[model samples]
Target chain A: MQPKRLSVLGVGLLGGSLGLAVKSVASDCRVIGYGHRRATLDAALALGAIDEGYDDPAAAVRDADLVVLCTPVSLLGEMLDRIAPFLADRAVVTDVGSTKASIVRLSEERHPGIRFVGSHPMAGSEKRGVQFAQSDLFRNAVCITTPTDATDREALEAVEGFWRGLGMRLKRCSPAEHDRLICDVSHLPHAIAAALVTMQEDAALDLVGKGFLDATRIAGGDGGLWRDIFLDNRQNLAAAIGRLRTSLDDLERLLTPESSEALRDWLDRAAERRQAALKP
Target chain B: MQPKRLSVLGVGLLGGSLGLAVKSVASDCRVIGYGHRRATLDAALALGAIDEGYDDPAAAVRDADLVVLCTPVSLLGEMLDRIAPFLADRAVVTDVGSTKASIVRLSEERHPGIRFVGSHPMAGSEKRGVQFAQSDLFRNAVCITTPTDATDREALEAVEGFWRGLGMRLKRCSPAEHDRLICDVSHLPHAIAAALVTMQEDAALDLVGKGFLDATRIAGGDGGLWRDIFLDNRQNLAAAIGRLRTSLDDLERLLTPESSEALRDWLDRAAERRQAALKP
Candidate 1:
């Protein structure tokens, strides 16, 4: 029951930082990182995120009590398929993936023998890789855990404890609910911001002001990661896109020459909505 | 010419802040503010952004050697017309409106007798009013000036000199060029963020990780003013939206099942582009 050793996959930003955070907070824990790139492994090693780095997933997960998947969302399923046989029966596998539904489904299929508890630590930066990684990135941030009925309660408890130990506030949700919730709060916004920036190439280039900077600060995020999120939570993302379009369309109507008063009223609601959203 | 006095119209964040900035660096210059709101006038007086406040547009501009319009783009022309009759013949009249083309056009048609130069200090926040005003807001920011053929060289020089005194980095461009540039850098991003955040009311309520926060932070801006910006620069805004959509579409394609290489390539490019853009 005591997880003395932890194995981290994809030692880039999320994985490297996770190793760094876990190793820093729990000094007794031995953290081993598995990186796809030699450069990434070296950087993570230099950063002291891990005692050592392994090039092979099988070699990395051999005796570790925990294996944390830190790769891209698109690679989550494949990672499980590849690392499944190497994992010990007692080893709990978790991921720092953005969406939960697909990861949960993949876990149920690919790692039936090993327990998987999907986690999303609400943290990070516009910067990527180990260099941008910080030990305290998840501190005071929300960490959601989605555990299916097939999940072992023991594994869930241990994952929750790890996140809590890393200074995260943990919440529990169903895989379906987590995906839908994340689509609204996380994924859909990326699509809207990206589309807005991409669509207005010339105008955006010419007149980027503080408002634009504030709006698209996240637009600079890795597009591939966001795109995977959108596709994974397609139904929820579509619904979110629809809701947002209504807001934009309403503004468009209010902007019509005859609707200045309506425009003012809409803005009041928007400002009110914005301030209200910021309260938490 | 020894300009003995100055006038500030609108008396909100930009106008009030400029009034204080102008007075702080040029101590001998007497500055007064004109605003429709009694509270704005009181706040401006309390903030010491103005020597006094005025209710009458004509009275405010009559004895002033400098007049800076700091209201919404929609009202700049009407305001110029209202104050033209009382503007000092030798005075330099300018504005801090977001979009320059429309305001400059307004100035050209409305005040042939008075010297009009258009300006936009590239700064601000969603939090407004005189209380949020600061004298140094203009001090290390870009001060954009839009000079037309009708613009007097001496008037432009005086405007530039005044802003320089406030410690601004002055940059000159045509009003159309200014609008075009801002569409890319400012207005488009706001539109995108706003739309993105609104996409999923429920999802946004749950997952809002730092990525979403960074992506949609500016979605919380003053909607009325932003709506005005969107309408005013519809053509450019539309173009920006288009470009962003293409980028999003391309990313979406890269995330689909068969494109792991493309996904990695996109993330690498995205990281590179963002890092490059972030560099000074």
Candidate 2:
């Protein structure tokens, strides 16, 4: 079923891309963008990512059948609270927040009257802003829908269906599981990249090769955005870091004794696993 | 002065590329490739990376005025010993090994009669073998030369001049300093990538994004090669790992108290440094 009106909050890369994707895939759906900055909303409208722009999120969602919150994780509860009273009774709300457990918990606590299903589309770039948004950002991307026993079945179906229309393959799991899984796959990598870059000396920057650049490429991402992610999912991220520390410690141990056979075996296994996992 | 004959032992990606670059820049130079595998040497010759192929290391360096050992770090000492008996009196020997201190020490101990200078060109890809060798691999790349007090000045000049002719920008340092710097920039990244991959669950691979892929891309590299580098420079790599641990610990501490300002400051600094350093 095509949404009568689809509203997106904070139309940056994820939100603007969602708008573009909705317009391209479901012609009948009217996309409305709500953002804090008029210039960003205007850019989204000018690029045809949204049919209309709104400075007021409440006004944008008044008639929307589906509303996707694409703001930073820290502001999810605040944004939901702002739009809760204006949301239609039949409206199905979802989010593209990086951390699922915190956002889902906040939505359930703050806007219990509204049906909020959580989603996290595993698609993004190091680049940011509405100017970098594309129509096919979610194509072939994995979108995780986190639904608990308390979630409305109809809202979950609508949210997953909307993402599927944009060519996303859906994975259904609990918000806690999503947080745990994403900690290893997404949040952990960002933290590692940041930590890796922080260890480098300013003078040695010129000596770096493509290996260092590729390994730490995500460290160049927006600070405020990642800071929110790191804080919102601190427990899972910390646990993941502990696992990484153990892995690294094992590697160091293998090196200390010059255990050539064991070290080569470890490297071989890692290479094989990465090759299989990273295949396009 | 251009050398009439330049021999490369264990001709693979680094060695074959060196051969190709030398041929392109010094038209009069004849490149002789020696390798354990005849097919590899034949491929190098067919690709014009080398003018001739030799199965015997002794025969390969017998008439050459310059010999470069392009073997793995673990085998550098053995390869030098194999060619020492046949090395021309005025020949300058060097290598493209990633770690310098161990190889330099081994060279100085094993082949004191031969003029051996250690060089590492900070250029490579996850892809390997002679088939992937490109003549311009070292063009605009940073090649560090490790020359100690015992290093022959004439050999040093010839090595520096050769890398310069191949369009490489040079940095001069001691073998220990080279190992220390590379541990932070090269070897440490490799270990981190491997550890990151090792921490992943097989089932979670489907959920990985570009961030995970880019961050662990080097984990898919040749196991033997990286294993050699990690083992050869264990002391410096261990030190770098300690620094990375401290950085990660600092991040975890910032996360524990919900220290938004501190976390943001750390992320902003990392992002700024990466952005500035990564600019072409």
Candidate 3:
């Protein structure tokens, strides 16, 4: 079921990339982009990220079969409400929000008639905006779809097939499970990076090398985007942070002559696990 | 003056790299490497990291104008003691140890009349050993010379000039200050990275991407080497870890809606600082 009219709201990195990818693969599909700022929409148009641009959310989804709301988590609920009355009858809608559980709940409660599926493409750089978007951004990347029991099977399949067609590896999981997993792997790492940088001594900045640079690279991410992620998945991320604190405390306690072997074992295991992850 | 013979003890990454770097620049200088393992010494020699290999520290230091001890922090004192008896009357001794205060103090107290200065080269990978050593490892890297009032003026200039000749940018600081700054920049980051991986839930590992990978890459560093570092500079490192804890606690406390502005500001400052560092 190829979407004749695919509308993408908030054409930033993720949305613009999706539009460009769709344009590359589905030549017949018309990709329309909607952005709060007309300059952004024009930028997406100039980059060939979208075939057309729309300033109004309702106008964007008017004749579209598939609508991808690609705004931050905080803006998703309101965007859904704004486009609800204008979404075509039986139109299949989805989102590229970081947190899935809240987005899924909002979609189900706010837009009763529209078929909405939650998606999170695990690809992006620290940089944002439509200018950074490219057709290959989703190539070889994992696109996790959060589909609940209440979701329409056909709609879920369409979303999965769409992402697969755009060169993404698909993983299906419940929205709750998706949130929990991303909290540990994604959200918590961001918070840790930020905390690491904030804790650095001003005098030591000149002595830092590649190790420090790599470790803190993600801390240079956009603050507004990360703050939304932190707030949306606050509980799970907080729990993950607690786990990290415990790990640090345990290591701190092991910093003794008698606990040398214990500390070595802990570090050895971490090295092994990280090495194993690099393997196929 | 260009050293006629350069002796390097513990010919692993740093030692082997120094030998290679010296050989690259000064073809007439003979580079001798000493190691605990015959295999490592032989490997260093075969890789052109050293012109000759020695098993005995005393034999290695004999007739050398410059001797760079590149062993772990725990072994530097013992290596200095072993080679003290055989050191040339005017031999300039220096160490490539991570912690400087202890090494400088050990040299002053344990081997009087031997001209020893402490240096910490701000270069290296998470990887180790002679096989990974390269001639250009120290190129454009900052080589911190921890020279105290007791350091012989001629020896200090020789050490500084030697590092500068190898293409390293030189910064001179007191040994105590070097330890304090490195604790914040290097050791604490390694601890945080290790703890992040150690605290990870196994079930969530499958979903990790570049953000987590970059944040924890240093956790894969050699365990024994890092253990020595953590123990040698326990006090300063402990203080750094405490600072990190306070930062994490502050971020955690700001997870609420009312503190969103505070969290954003924290992240913004971190981002700005990191961005500023990428510029030359």
Top candidate, metric lDDT: 2
Model 1, span B32-91: residue lDDT tens: 889998888988988888888988888888789888888878788888889887876687
lDDT of each: 0.75, 0.89, 0.87
Name the candidate, 1 or 2, with the larger TM-score value. Answer: 2
Candidate 1 per-residue lDDT over residues A189-274, each given as its tens digit: 66655555444434233434555555555657766676576567777766665676566665555546577666556655545555
Give the runs in model 2 whose Cα sits over 4 Å from its true position: A1-4, B1-4, B24-28
Could you tell me the TM-score of candidate 2? 0.94
**Runs in model 1 lying further than 4 Å from the true structure:** A1-3, A200-206, A223-247, B1-4, B37-39, B164-169, B227-255, B258-280
- Models ranked on DockQ: 2, 3, 1
Q: lDDT per residue, candidate 3, B1-280, as tens digits?
A: 5899999998888888899899899999999889989999889989998888989999899899999989988899999989999999999999888899988998888776899989888888788888999899999888899988889999999999999999988888999999999888788888988887777767667777777888889988899988988888888988888888899889889899899998888888889888775653
Q: What CAPRI-style quality would you assign to candidate 2?
A: medium
Best by DockQ: 2
Comparing only chain B with the true structure, the TM-scores of all models are: 0.91, 0.96, 0.96
> Backbone clash tally for model 1?
34
Estimate, for each residue in A28-98, the C-alpha lDDT of model 3 and write its tens digit.
Answer: 99999899899999999999988889899998998999999999889999999999888888799999888
Worst 10 residues of 3 chain A by lDDT: A271-280
Query: How close is candidate 3 at the interface, in terms of C-alpha RMSD after superposing the true interface residues?
Result: 1.1
Q: List the residue pairs that clash in candidate 3.
A: none
Ranking by lDDT: 2, 3, 1
Query: Of the pair 2 and 3, which is ahead by DockQ?
Result: 2
